[model samples]
Target: MKLLAGAMLSAILLYLVLLLIPGYPPVGEIPFYRDAGFSVIAHRGGRGLVPGNTIEAAENAVDIGSDIVEIDVHMTTDNVLVVRHDAVIDTTTNGSGAIANMELSDIQAYDAGFHEIDYPEASWEIPLTVPSLDSLFTALPNHRYLIELKPTTLPPADALCELILEHQLQNQVVVGSFHSSVLQYFRRSCPSIPTSLGKSEITLFVLLERIKLGHLFNSPGYSIQVPIKYKGFNILTPEFIILAHNLNMRVDVWTINDPKEMKVVSNWGVDGVITDRPDIAISLRERLSFL
Candidate 1:
């Protein structure tokens, strides 16, 4: 009984020490994406009006005045980091293969704009090609990118950091991933780059928030990005925003497109909104002078 008690005490001490550790220091000379206040983030490059994750969609998002363009990164078989949302190309493109098994040249050759079938009114003036991360950065060098790493589909940290360096975009990009390992990899190698809370990290945050004990642990990431609802529970409450801000962390919600819903969260004091319709959100913010 004494031995077991001692082990438990040791575990508790270790956990407490871990909780007090701070997040990695940010890595940019430029203060791009430094603010999280009442901003509009284009989801999948604001895909409702254009094909998702294409350069055209990115251009459209910038033209529409979104504060950030959220793009997913998947490495090709040839080890090129490309802007794509899926591990498999069959759903969003004309081709049929896992992105992990395809070369960059072949993946780029596929008609990425095929998803535009859903939007007949939006003209595909330029060929919608699957853009490499380099291409996307080149297309919108001045804009911010919220790049989600799909390390399970492709190696993310090393390649992603390299690209950020090559493009001088470490400050302009916010790296996030559902997987903790991917975020950890980035944090270790590129601690200066800002990142969102990983899935497990946010899960723990939700639990602590539920019990009103969230202030106990230091945040693992610089920011938190969540959907408005989780398991039907409204997670982006005003109180939740207060808790995050108290910790000096920014809170951003994702995938919100409805104008009414957008207004609701905006009122909740969220730092930003990620949406498939940045145009509508931008207009609403403008009309209300919310920004």
Candidate 2:
């Protein structure tokens, strides 16, 4: 009876230990990919505080100690690749019409900064200009960049890849796109640069599918940027981060601006975050000792 009771106790302890352990996919086996120091990537060069994708924004992000400055690229009608968020200039710029429909010379004619207001009733206008990718690279050569390739009518993905290579900026850049075709093209042509797939549709089915098959199709080195909330599961949950880490893939959630949410996500051990408020994110990182 004594021996049987001892055996039962041992079984109970083992069960509790197993329950505490996390679950991950079977193919998730890259040992060296431990969570490094958390990296803060400023989305659209910290759009919350400055004109997005502009030189001023990039400079501000860097000044605040962001690990990387993110920017979007779209080619003009004349095939000049410029940094702007939208395919059209109507929203963020003073200019009108699709960016691809306008020549670089035409785009340069407008005052890109005229429409911007720092605060309501403040009425302070900062002069802004859309910068070429080359100009951005030149301005912040030492800083890393997360370049999102905007799908446009001009300057194909191949041409963009060529420009990156010609500038020898491959090592300092991580290219991403919502278009999987662009990612596939980069995978095939510019294999050296790291790539990430943006998460647009967040569903349980898609998350599970990506977990199971992402490595097979997306290459082993690729990462996924998912939302903090997906299919009723908060991505900042320990289970989610462990699952992603085990898969040899880094998880980056986008547009997370709240300091509390940033703390929660960082505590959960997400590898990185893309935020429009780099200043806020950096402050949160310091407060939480997430760095």
Candidate 3:
């Protein structure tokens, strides 16, 4: 037992020395991170203020001083990519069906802007249908976008990649997905575009950070878009943010709407705050700039 313990202790000492001495190569900066700062990313294009993922919400977010208009995309049956949060249109739109199973023309017949909360007396005449990715790019030519691809049986990466290339939006967009496979496909298909860490990659990063092996992690994404807490564990600490920076990766915390929490994370030196309230985030950024 003593001999085994001594051997284990020696191995641990060796690891500590190696960890403390060796220098790792810093990750190369991506085009998306060029001159980037504490960005105010409008989640679903400021969903709290307008109908989520609609063109109006996107315009509102940009006009209110958001640095990035975040949106979600799902491919239609006819291979057109539409802006939406869910795989199905049941919750957000007037008509209902799976996005992948319906053609774009069929899908747009439903009013996506008919939010009961925003419009208590929702009218069919006030029809703001789902906008195509192509239309959005045409409308917001100079804006930055963070697009999350919803997981689906119909592969959307190739279509999305072609569109980005067609629009010459390589530098203005960061693509992300909850499914790592989808992100992998996108990365392979669209090498010029930057991407946020997928769910599995995020899990791997957290695990490595906890074990003090963060420096050894070779991240494939340009940034990580995470919630402040996941399953009750705080994920956005100063240490976590530093580790990401050390790896040359940007850290973007998501869905933060509270003024206090936004201030807290901004103070911690996060690269971006993804919020449904860009108005609040922009206001906070202005207040902090003077300090």
Candidate 4:
């Protein structure tokens, strides 16, 4: 009994020592994060304001003073990267086919102005064509962007890297993807560009936070962009925000449109809020400044 008791005490001491150890140093400089403050990231270029991922949507988002326009990308049949949120374009556009199966010209031929359910206020009288990432970047040359890669059979890391480098947007864009393999591949192909936490990384982070060992969590990603809550568990706790800031990482919650929720998250000191309503978020930021 005495031997067992001694072993237990030693294990407890080791655990306490580990808890006292400091975490890894801050991650390397994320150019997109440089000089940034309380970013108002437009979700799908402010889908609530207009047809998502279209040129009009992006323009309106910028006009409303959004800090960063978050978009999704999918590769077309002709090896072109287009700004879109899904592999199938049926929902967002009037088209009805997989993006991978259609060429850029084919996809652009269809009307992308199909926000009947989401944005009835936005105009859809004229046809809005889907845009290529190249064109989007050209139109908004100086803007910051958070581009997410939707799942694709063909790996698009090399193509994406080439495009970013070609346009000299290495410092203005951050890549995001749910697939760990995609993010891992992008990191390997283009280490210069910053990325967000992948699925596995987020899981590990939340687990650590739950176990009270969040200080040890480390990754090369520039930020954590999570929903306010996931699967019925609260994620935006005060402790979570403080821990992320302590590690020099920013935490940005997504898809928050309610005015009350916006005020709550902003009060929690999140780095950014990804929302479908850029106008609302930008306005809230103004009010927060006064407070």
Candidate 5:
């Protein structure tokens, strides 16, 4: 009887090992990570690799395997929407005027590549023409876009929404703005596309406000651009991430560069991360098999 009992116990232990083996593979095992669809968004078309907000930059980001190319949008004097980062062209381009004050033709005269010396390998030259939103959309039809609406005087949110819907890109775009009022306008006008709320600070009050407003506008996600330093004191904490998850609202943090911080935040199970160096982010993700 004792010998029979020992054999039965050995059989039970072997079965348990077989069950655990499939769940937790041995170290150095290469589990399929591609099943996870975590996105790597290029912040301003990956400012680390090329001149920001330019077509070349966007292309480079795509070549580097970024899931989305983020761009900023402003309006020309004639109210034609164009892809650009700043309200003015003085810093990013050779032209020295406000984008809101210049005609599309006038904007075409500036050299966006002249000041892009930080990336010597890019070999970008002067006389970079500003690209219209339509042109960018046509150029990269396959790539997903994260469009940031700059605070400008021209092209009302309603009109922009019309154009976006006209192109049938309502499902492929994520729109955001620093101006809450502008985002609110977008939310009211374009209910089909997802809108992200950008805020400099995050608080429980702010999170509550975002949640309340999000429900009103039916926004899919809340975006916070600040650092983790804002987590406990003023902004949403890890607890907030938990809360957002419970509410079924996605959370996206912006412009995070540190790999360590990226790992930490990714572990928090946020929906996405916006970063300037997508290459580094991709490497980290690959190393850890996070995505």
Candidate 6:
């Protein structure tokens, strides 16, 4: 009990130390994490409508008229990049264990749609299995992928780069990682691909934005991807959007599915939105225009 208390106190101290640090923390600084789309990005390949991050979900995103599809990728024990959101396979798949501990074959054998099978809104016609990054690239050559290297773990950046290069998808895909190190390393290996600002970078940018220090907008990544409300604070404002656009950067809000909120952000001139229901967003976009 004493040991647990000591660990908790240490964690609090670390948190306080981080809070006290000023002038851009090391994780926020990405000199080359530099610079996509002005349309909807299907979050987890429209997870609301289909199984998340599977081949079927991606296809559905394209069919639903999502301008771009977003999916999470993780590296397996065999060092192969496969599409799965949660770090552990237990939540989304029939099998249990971390993706890092499971080999490619092991991951493939598990049913990726286990959780969603019982959900009435989800589609079951598509037999869901873990998809390889390579297969996704090949399957949806026409649609762009917003590859999210999840913060749960640092996936193999080099291996991802190799696949991106091999598939000739440098321009067709954009990547983002909340972890600054992953984005930095991936950018170093594949500079042509665009990445979004990390969490630290986003915090700094938001601070600069709120202070009206537009000149201090030195975003490390090509674009800024954020939630509409980060911990109850509405970060997606007109001024922030203007600032990003002024710097030749794009602002995309994630996981927005509400029609009213979509209209609000669209009117604010946000470059894009990441949504679980791309169909709804697409409909909203169409209604916004005067035909």
Clashing pairs in 4: none
In terms of lDDT, the poorest run of 10 residues in model 1 is 21-30
Give the Å shift of residue 182 in candidate 6.
Answer: 1.4
Candidate 2 deviant stretches above 4 angstroms? 1-36, 116-124, 152-154, 198-206, 209-221, 230-237
Model 1 residue runs over 4 Å out of place are 1-30, 33-36, 116-126
Candidate 6, residue 223: Cα displacement in angstroms equals 1.4
Judged by whole-model lDDT over C-alpha atoms, candidate 6 comes out at 0.78
Which 10 consecutive positions of candidate 5 have the poorest summed lDDT? 24-33
**Which clashing pairs does model 6 show?**
35-222
Query: TM-score, each model?
Result: 0.86, 0.77, 0.91, 0.92, 0.75, 0.83
- Clash totals, every prediction: 2, 0, 0, 0, 1, 1
| 181-238: candidate 6 lDDT, tens digit per residue | 8888887878877687888878888887786555465666767888888788988889
Q: Candidate 3 local accuracy as lDDT?
A: 0.85
What's the candidate order when arranged by decreasing TM-score? 4, 3, 1, 6, 2, 5
Task: Identify the superior model by lDDT, candidate 4 or candidate 5.
Answer: 4
The sequence of per-residue lDDT tens digits that candidate 2 reaches over residues 154-238 is 2456667887787787777777777765666766887766776544322342455544432223233346677776568665457
**Which segments of candidate 3 are over 4 A away from where they belong?**
1-23, 117-125, 152-154
Which is superior by TM-score, 1 or 2?
1
Residue 184 local lDDT, model 5:
69
- lDDT per residue for candidate 1 within 85-199, as digits (tens), equals 8888887677889888889989878788665542334745555678889888887899988889976533567889888988888778888999898788788888767788899
**Candidate 4: worst-modelled 10 consecutive residues by lDDT:** 114-123
Question: Residue 121, candidate 5: how far off, in angstroms?
Answer: 9.6
Q: Per-residue CA lDDT of candidate 4, range 1-291, in tens? A: 999999999989987987999877777767789879889999989988887787788899999899899999999888899998888888867779999889999998888886564355655767888899999999989989999988644367778889999999999999988888889889988988888888888888888888788888987688989997889988778888887887788889998988789888888889898989989888877876721
lDDT string for model 5 (1-291, tens) is: 999999999988875665455221111211111222577888888877887787777888899888878888888778888888878888767778988888888987887777754343465654566788887777787778888888733245766787788788876777777776677667777777776655522333255444433222222343334456554543435765665544444556676877887887888776567888889888887889764
